[model samples]
Target: MYEYKCVELRSKMFGGALSGDKLERVLNEWAAKGWQLKSTAAVDVKGRIGPGGTDGLLITFERQKG
Candidate 1:
């Protein structure tokens, strides 16, 4: 069975405001890359890899079988 997890992403840096639907669209795009859609509840984190504290949870296709 596939599993899901929560995710979070910032907007201001992306140029446009982020919406829940937008996040879903992202999730779908990510699914194409093999990451399953888990959750969208994101918390705040400081700093960033790019402009606008750009960071969020990514997905993995293979579960750790723990």
Candidate 2:
């Protein structure tokens, strides 16, 4: 069996921008906890922006259930 986890990366967490280094650190931390990245999605806060002005990233992860 497998377990899943979801992490929300908000732009505001990095002063309104998501930096690669910061993201890597977060991912690495999860990896240390035995979670593997599964997928990612850009989440827009509003529909009127036409995919612009994304609020953050939705990161999905999975791992074996021990």
Candidate 3:
């Protein structure tokens, strides 16, 4: 049988305005689940760390062969 899975990390300008370090942490955790950072997307809401703005990120994880 074939199995498939996915993980998504979203921070709507909360968690202290998501930073690369924090994002990396999320990526690392998911990485353990065989997930890797694939891509990311974001939009300006109002402002953020530098300026409150909305943001979105996409991560892709896939099973590997042994």
Candidate 4:
């Protein structure tokens, strides 16, 4: 069995950069807790302008059930 986690990255919070020290810290923190990255993808956040207009990132992680 496995467990999963999702991390959302917002452009406003990250200044449009996805990979950074903050992200690394988060990953490391989870890694220490036995989580591993499974996948990542660009997500389009719905905005006032239109759908698929806002840039975002989605990080998926998985870990063995304990």
> Which residue pairs show backbone clashes in model 3?
35-61, 45-54, 47-51, 47-52, 47-53, 48-51, 48-52, 48-53
What is the descending TM-score order? 2, 4, 3, 1
Q: What is the lDDT of residue 51 in candidate 2?
A: 66
Which residue pairs collide in model 2, if any?
A: none
Worst 10 residues of 2 by lDDT: 45-54
Please write out the lDDT profile of model 1 over residues 1-66, one tens digit for every residue: 545444446664445466667766876776776675544444454544645454443333332233
Candidate 3 ranges beyond 4 A from true positions: 1-8, 43-54
User: What stretches of model 1 exceed 4 Å from their correct place?
Assistant: 1-8, 49-66
Model 1, C-alpha of 52: deviation from truth (Å): 9.6
Q: Estimate, for each residue in 1-66, the C-alpha lDDT of model 3 and write its tens digit.
A: 323444444565346467888877777887787654555545434442575445555455555444
In candidate 4, position 44 carries an lDDT of 78
Tell me how far candidate 1 lies from the true structure as C-alpha RMSD in angstroms.
5.3
- When 2 and 3 are scored with TM-score, the better candidate is 2
- Whole-model Cα lDDT per candidate? 0.53, 0.87, 0.57, 0.80
Model 4, 1-66: lDDT tens digits are: 999999877665676665678778878988998999998888875655555556777889999999
CA shift of 41, model 4, Å: 0.3
How far residue 48's Cα lies from its native spot in candidate 2, in Å, is: 20
Stretches > 4 Å off in candidate 2: 45-54
lDDT of 2 by residue, 1-66 (tens): 999998888787788889899999999999999999999998864435366564889999999999
Candidate number achieving the greatest TM-score relative to the actual structure: 2
